[model samples]
Target: MAKELSVEDAEKKARELLDRRIASVRTLVTARQRLAELREQVADADREDVRLYNAALNDGWSPDELRKLGLSEPEKKARTRRRAAAKKTAADAPGVDHQEPAPVPAPEPS
Candidate 1:
């Protein structure tokens, strides 16, 4: 059997429980804030990774080489397709000249 609490003792216990609940809520909020910060850091790191990968690609580094260096491959963007489509549309439109310059003939061998 459990001992019965006096009115004062019961009220004190209730206040203690409420205080613990408030502390738990505060800790949860702090944890959430830290999680948000971590997510932002991860996003920033990913951007840097992509930027470096693209730079390496532009510098003639092979995908295999990058992989050997333990770097992740950057995702290909649809921008190239979009740009090609735009160019085609503009060239097909009236008043647009998309002709390539004529190549100069090589000099005859001596």
Candidate 2:
């Protein structure tokens, strides 16, 4: 006859598996929160990168030399206006107030 698992043994096994799952989920949550924070930091760093690149260029550093040093040209920041204004863009709604243009005159016969 086969022996059945003891109650103590079953509790130990369940705790082991559930603990592992909890640890993994905790790690994932921590990583996702850190990833979001890092993204904001990276965006701030990009703006600073552009500023420093421009300063170096103004300091007489040649573009070719900078390229050889592996520092590529930084891109311009996209947000020229305030945050609220930037977010409130034209949402591709249809233009209902349409106006007709004047008709062109036909050429006289030669």
Candidate 3:
């Protein structure tokens, strides 16, 4: 047997239930927004990872085919030329010593 409630009690119970439902909906909405923010952050990190990987590929070392003995002649010649130029520059500069001489200490008096 169901107990009959007065009009005022029924209205109050309905208002409380409605308030709880509204709060639950608000919590769900907040959780969904947070999930969306996390997804965007993950997407941004993925984009940056791809960018870094591509940059590394573009600026990285040569392939094995390019490192063969006969195939690397031009690179060797360019490196040699650069080294010669650097040596010439160092030789031409005055008051600049390239060799490391022995360090001399002050003589201690008795």
Candidate achieving the largest TM-score: 1
The true-structure Cα RMSD of candidate 1 reads: 23.6
In model 2, which regions exceed 4 Å deviation? 51-73, 76-110
- Which ranges in model 3 have alpha carbons more than 4 Å from their true place? 1-4, 61-110
Give one digit per residue, the lDDT tens place, for model 1 in 56-83.
9999999999889987596654654434
* lDDT (10s digit) by residue, model 3, range 1-110: 99989999999999999999999999999999999999999878766765654554577635444445333312221234334444457656898887889899989998
Clashing pairs in 1: none
- Sliding window of 10 residues with minimal summed lDDT for model 2: 84-93
- Of the two candidates 1 and 3, the one with more favorable lDDT, higher being better, is 1
Model 2, global lDDT: 0.87
User: Tens-digit lDDT track for model 2 on 1-110?
Assistant: 89999999999999999999999999999999999999999999997898899899999998899999998888765767655544433453466435567899999999
Q: Model 3 misses residue 73 by how many Å? A: 31
